[model samples]
Target: MGKEFIELFEQWADHYDETVTGHDLEYKEVFRHYEAILAEVAKRTFGHVIEFGPGTGNLTEELLKRGRTVTAFEPSPAMRNLAQEKIGNRAEIKEGDFLSFEFKKSVQSIVSSYAFHHLTDKEKAEAIAAYGNILESGGKIVFADTMYESVEAYKQAIKDASEKGFHNLAEDLEREYYTTIPILKEMLEANHFTVSFEKMNDFVWIMEALKK
Candidate 1:
C-alpha cells in the first residue's frame, strides 16, 4: 500500500491544507483549483461510496453535503485524525489504504482525489482488478489526480518544474507513481471499466471509470 509515505503525511498533516490552498508556491500549480476539483468529484459520485485516501476529509465533506454515504480509508494516522476531526461521525474515516481497505457493504461508486499517485503502476493495476471484482455492473470509480497525456508530457512537466526552480515539485514528479493516460486507460479497460478523462489542471486529470 501507500504506508511508506505515512511519516511524510504525518509531518504534512498540519500544513497539508495550506499547501493545497496555494500557500506553497512550489506546489501551487499542482493543487490549483483545489475546491473545484473536489466539487467535481463529488458531483460525479452517487450512492454508497468508498473513498480512498480521504486526506483531511475535504472530498468527504463534499460527498456528505450531497447526501451521499461515505466510508473513507486513509493510511496515515495523523491524516485520519485530522479527517475525523473535520468530518466527525458523519462518515467513517478508517485506517486503511488503496489496496488494503475493507468494507462490508457494496458501494455504487469508489472515489478519490489527489491521492492515487501513491501507488505504483503495478499496484494500481492490482487495485483496479480488486475493485472490478467487487463492483457490480454500472458501478463507477471517480478519481482526480496528477496524470500526463504522454511520456513526453510527463518528462516536460518535470523539466518545466526544474527550470522554474521548483526542485521539490520536480523531485516529487520524478519520485511518485504518477502515470500516463494511455496506461491508465488500458488498465481500467482490462478490468472491465469504460473510462474517460477530463483535464482539471496542468497537473491533474479527472478519471471516471464505470464498471461494465
Candidate 2:
C-alpha cells in the first residue's frame, strides 16, 4: 500500500501543493484551517511534533516556522526529498506509514494535515490509540483532514456524485474511508483523550484532542 502511493506521489511531489490546493474540492480552504490547528499546538508545547504524511512540507514548513520540530511519517521517497529540500534540518523525515511507525521518544504534540483520511476505519482507531501511547500526559493532537458527517453521509455523497456523472470519483470515495468529527471524538474519548472540533468547511475539520 505504502509503495504504491509512494510511486504515485513521487510523480506529484513537484506540483502537489499547487494542484491539491485548488483542484481538490475537499481540500479547498484547508490551508488556513491547518495553520489555526498548528497555532493551537504551538500555544501548548515547544517540543517535537509528530506528523503523518507531511507531503511536500506545506504544514511541515508551518510547524518549523513556529519553532516546533517535526518527526514526519512520510512514505513517498520523492515527496520526502522535496519536503527535506523545503524544510532542511528543521524536521526529522522518516519514510514510513503511521500504522508501522513508532515514536523514538515522547512528543508533546501530534499533527496531520489532510493525511488521516488515507487510513481505513479500523486503522484509524488503532492509529488514534497509538497516538495516545506515544504522547506524554496532556499531550495534544491537532488533526485537520477531509471528513464526512457520517458513514451514511459518505454513502449519500457517493450517490450524489454518481448522479452528477462522477462515476469514477464515486468509486474512489467508496474505496477510501474518511471520518466524521463526532466519530473521531468518540474514538479519542474512548482512548481517554478529551476532544473538540472546528470546521474549515463542509468537508474539512480541525480535530483537537488532549491526552488525559
Candidate 3:
C-alpha cells in the first residue's frame, strides 16, 4: 500500500502544485511553526537531520534558511526535480521512500509534514519503528499532519472536497484510523517515543516525539 501510494505521488508530483492550492499556505505555515519546534528539538540533540517525504522542498528550504543541514528523502521523481530546482546547492535531496530508505549515520532529527496520513495503519506503525531505529538516543521527530477534531469535521472536509470535485478526499482523511491526538500519542509511545501533541488548527496536528 505504501509503495502504491508512492507511485501515485510520483505520477501526481508534476501536477501536485496545481491540484492542491491549499498546500501552498499549509507549507508556508509548516515552516513558520517548524522553526520553533526545531529549535526546541535541536537544543536537546545534534547531528545531521533527515526529512522524510519532503514534497518540493518547501520545508527543506526553510530548514536551510535556518542554517541547518538536512538530507531530504523524497520518493517522487517529479518532486525531487522540483526540489532540486528550488533548493539548488542548499541541501542534499535523496530520491527514495521514507519507510525503506537507509541512512549511513544516525540522525538527530527526523521530520515530516502532511505525508504520514498517506500510509496505512500498519505502515504508519512500521515507519515509527523504523524512525526509532534510525534516530540516535535523545533524538526527536516532529510531524505535522491533518487530524480531525471530530467525525463531523472530517465529514465536512470530505463534503467540501466533494463540492470542489475532489471526491476522493475522504480517503485522505485518516480519522478512522489515526487522526486524533490520543491515537498519535499512543502510536509514538508504543514505539518508545515520549510524545507531546499540539493542535495547530481545526485540521492540523503537530506532534513532537523524543526517543526515550
For every candidate in turn, the CA RMSD to the true structure comes to: 0.8, 2.9, 4.3
Ranking by TM-score: 1, 2, 3
- Which has the higher TM-score value, candidate number 2 or candidate number 3? 2
Task: Please name the candidate that would achieve the greatest lDDT relative to the true structure.
Answer: 1
**Model 1 lDDT at residue 191:** 88
TM-score of each: 0.98, 0.84, 0.77
lDDT of 1 by residue, 1-212 (tens): 57787887899898999999999999998899999999999999888999999988899999999999998999988889999999899999988999998776678999999889999999999999988876768999999999999999999999999999999899989888899999999999998899999998899999999998
- The lDDT, on a scale of 0 to 1, for candidate 1 is 0.92
Point out where model 2 deviates above 4 Å. Answer: 1-4, 23-46, 163-171
| True-vs-predicted CA distance for residue 11, candidate 2, Å | 3.8
Per-model lDDT: 0.92, 0.75, 0.70
lDDT string for model 3 (1-212, tens) is 15566667777678665544445542333334544443443343346778888787767766776667789888777788888899999887887776768687888888876677767667787888988988888989887777665657767876765566554554554333435566667889999999877765455677789999
Pitting candidate 1 against candidate 3, the one with the higher lDDT is: 1
CA error at residue 173 for candidate 2, angstroms: 2.0
Clashes of 3: 0
* Candidate 2 displacement at residue 91 in angstroms: 1.6
Worst 10 residues of 1 by lDDT: 1-10
Cα displacement (angstroms), candidate 2, residue 135, comes to 0.5
